[model samples]
Target: MSHSLSMPASCRASLRTSFAMSGALVATALLLPLTAHADQQSSETPAASGETASYDTTDESPRSAYLSDWYNQNVTVIGSKDIRFGPQKIDDIYLEYEFFGRKGPLDLYGYIDMPKFFGIGNAADSGAFDGGSPIFAEIKPRLSLNELSGRDLSLGPISEWYLAANWIYDWGHNSDNRQNTLYTGLGTDIDTGSPLGMSFNFYGKYQWENYGAENENSWDGYRAQLEYNYPLASFDNGASLFYAGFTNYDFGSDLGDGDSTRTNEAVVATNAFVYSFTHLRFLAVARYFHNGGQWNDGSELNFGDGDFRVRSTGWGYYLGVGWQF
Candidate 1:
């Protein structure tokens, strides 16, 4: 006795229409700030007499200013399916919400990842009730040191530097297991001036079990990540094409065993192509995950097992739409 759930055609049609309308509204909102800023800049007149205007000039370019103060605020909704290949093939659907914004000199970014399993009868009866819950939630805040110091540190391609911090929480699908992670580090934003913008970050992390005995002791680790986005083309209709990607590497000091005290735990990479239309953006993403040392041993499913034990690579794809204001 199994049951399944499927979305009705009417519901899907309604959702599509709602998204289109929302995109139009969001695009208008995003453009308003730019229009106002442009007007302000154009209206700037010479200072009266010998007096000098005290306009802020910390940011190097008008585009950067707009991004930091206005264009950075965005909300994205993504639907993705993850396929795990092993003796027991597992596939799951996830809905994700991502937000990025700025408050004064502080930049905030976060996401909620929710996993859902349809076509499964009652979740409670199938022991899959937890599928509707959030699988992970992370929030990261960064403080711009250069801006706060009231100095323009634009050297070469490097435009600004910041202090970054992250808080992450993870939950198990059907268990009380929970984990919390704290990260702090340094980061920089780079302006390539060639449609490609880059960012680099290095962080130290501390992880501990929040409610489960699965993780007995706390662990310390270090991570480095590089991210970039490039605009490929633009059309007169306000549509554009872009490429974006990120790579992350993690090293853990306490996850090793026996005589080994440090090990490379994981490396993850993602590449995406984005099609932008005014205030709406659609993205297709491809990702790869590599696990080693303690990570590979503990998360065996991620590395495969039995006949698929030799498979050490995992991949996933994502499709998403974003709205900005």
Candidate 2:
């Protein structure tokens, strides 16, 4: 027998109301620092002097420098369903938290994804014992080689280069279902200088993975990404915006077992519409995925009875809210 689950009307309405209130709080938080800065500027301005004051361009205030580096940092909380988008679906609610920021020159980005606090649905339907309960975390830190070397590596369109490393951990419902992965890569950042401020990234990565089960895998791959954002319209309090990105990955044959069948390839695309208030952002996102080869999940290789059957393609949607600091 098969079954389906859906959120009730009242629960969805309550979630919508909570999101509205959260957005208002985020806006207030974002405005307070600006308001303080404005007040400080007003108090510091010289009183009605006959002579005009000249500004110094070389010297920058400590507060201004700090704010420049940290003001745009943000954390987003999202509620999503069927994040994996599969033939075997995880129908329960899931919460994801993402963070993006900079610590000095190194750029940091990561997300934590897990099911809701309370578990719902039957054990078999939830994949409780099969390593499909969906708990994953990843962190990537990229060090700018150009900045560290104090040299410009720009070659026509490429603007910056970096040495990147990433660590990922995945946990299934049981202790026997776990995987850890590490990746080191060379990457470049490109600025297109277009009307939409489009950007691109290229990466050549070597990946190593260890699964709790018998089989393990390693491979080399290259990834390409394109990203852009546009402002659609403005309102008295906020603005509507559109953002989109695409990513492609190509991997070589498995290094450990020398099996071409164990290699993986994938392409993913995402689009979102965001509404921005004083300090908060609300967004709706749609994503598409195309997968091929034995490691279709992009993390580990799965072997079936006598062949590989992991290839899949699907789409999913998410609604989220973010607070900028």
Candidate 3:
């Protein structure tokens, strides 16, 4: 019981809502599918060659063609799904989504995994266009429920079509406490050439206690960077490839004794490689991070404003994994 109050109200509400809704949605979705077979069985579906039938059965008719087309033309639908998230990166859908297009089956096709890499062709090379530098478009719907994580609703056509974009403003009864956030940004991927993929992104990121964390913790900062990493035949199976990004960080106030680490810069360097396991479907990213900061972790540093103190340097490594559905 002591631990209950320590958790924010938003967390509790989300928990209860998810528990109730998840079960209901799953049951309703599964129920409709189960009755499909029974309906077909009760229909005038053609009987086996040797069996007697109750309804007229004709071939080469419009009705027959319709049913045949419905059955034969495969409906390959990779559905929009609900994924539950937890604290650990294992459940961080945003991070996973960010990297999924590269390793997933639609791999290199459905996702743009590179930026500023000329490994693939542009829209003009597809022969679908007869002019200089053909322009293309693609649109997608971004959906999420609840008032806290994002806007109650957002539907707009972004300028870049091959990629979908969003501007999320979430609020709720307990919103400003933990997740008092205001952010706007765009994200999307483009075709590099053909099999090669490219992803481009631009966003101004900031956070206020990230609705799920403790009340006083907040994240307010702006970061701008680009990432370029793809298959490099210059190396073995793209091993020992390089990905570099430079972005700045400006921490916010109202942190309640939290470090006033703002107006600082961070440079990103990673030498990553991939391992394929046909036995078990999983993609792992082994990245070494060289974080360049004026003040880093485990360093003797000082905050320069009126001798207010802070540390501004750090270096570390992180492991991220992606598994097939």
- Which has the greatest lDDT? 1
Model 2 spans > 4 angstroms off: 1-77, 85-87, 118-135, 173-176, 202-217, 253-263, 292-311
Considering TM-score, which of the candidate structures 1 and 2 is the better prediction for this target? 1
Q: Residue-wise lDDT of candidate 3 within 200-247, one digit each (tens)? A: 334444454443433223344444322222332222221112121212
lDDT score, residue 270, model 1? Answer: 59
Clashing residue pairs in candidate 1 (N, C-alpha, C atoms within 3 angstroms): none
Window of ten residues with lowest summed lDDT in model 2: 18-27
Candidate 1 lDDT tens digits, 1-325: 0000111111111211100000011110000001111111222322222111112234553332223332233445544433221112234444444444444566555545554533332222211254434455566567878879999977787777878775666665534445567779987776666545566667887766543433335646788866654446654344556555665577765554532322346665656666654345666666565642223422333223243232324765556566533
Worst 10-residue lDDT window, candidate 3: 22-31
Residue lDDT tens for model 2, 99-184: 43334456545545564424543332343333464666655556777889999888887776767655556665554445565666
lDDT assessment of candidate 1: 0.43
How does each model score on lDDT?
0.43, 0.39, 0.21
Q: 1 or 3: which has the higher lDDT?
A: 1
> What would you estimate as the lDDT of candidate 2?
0.39
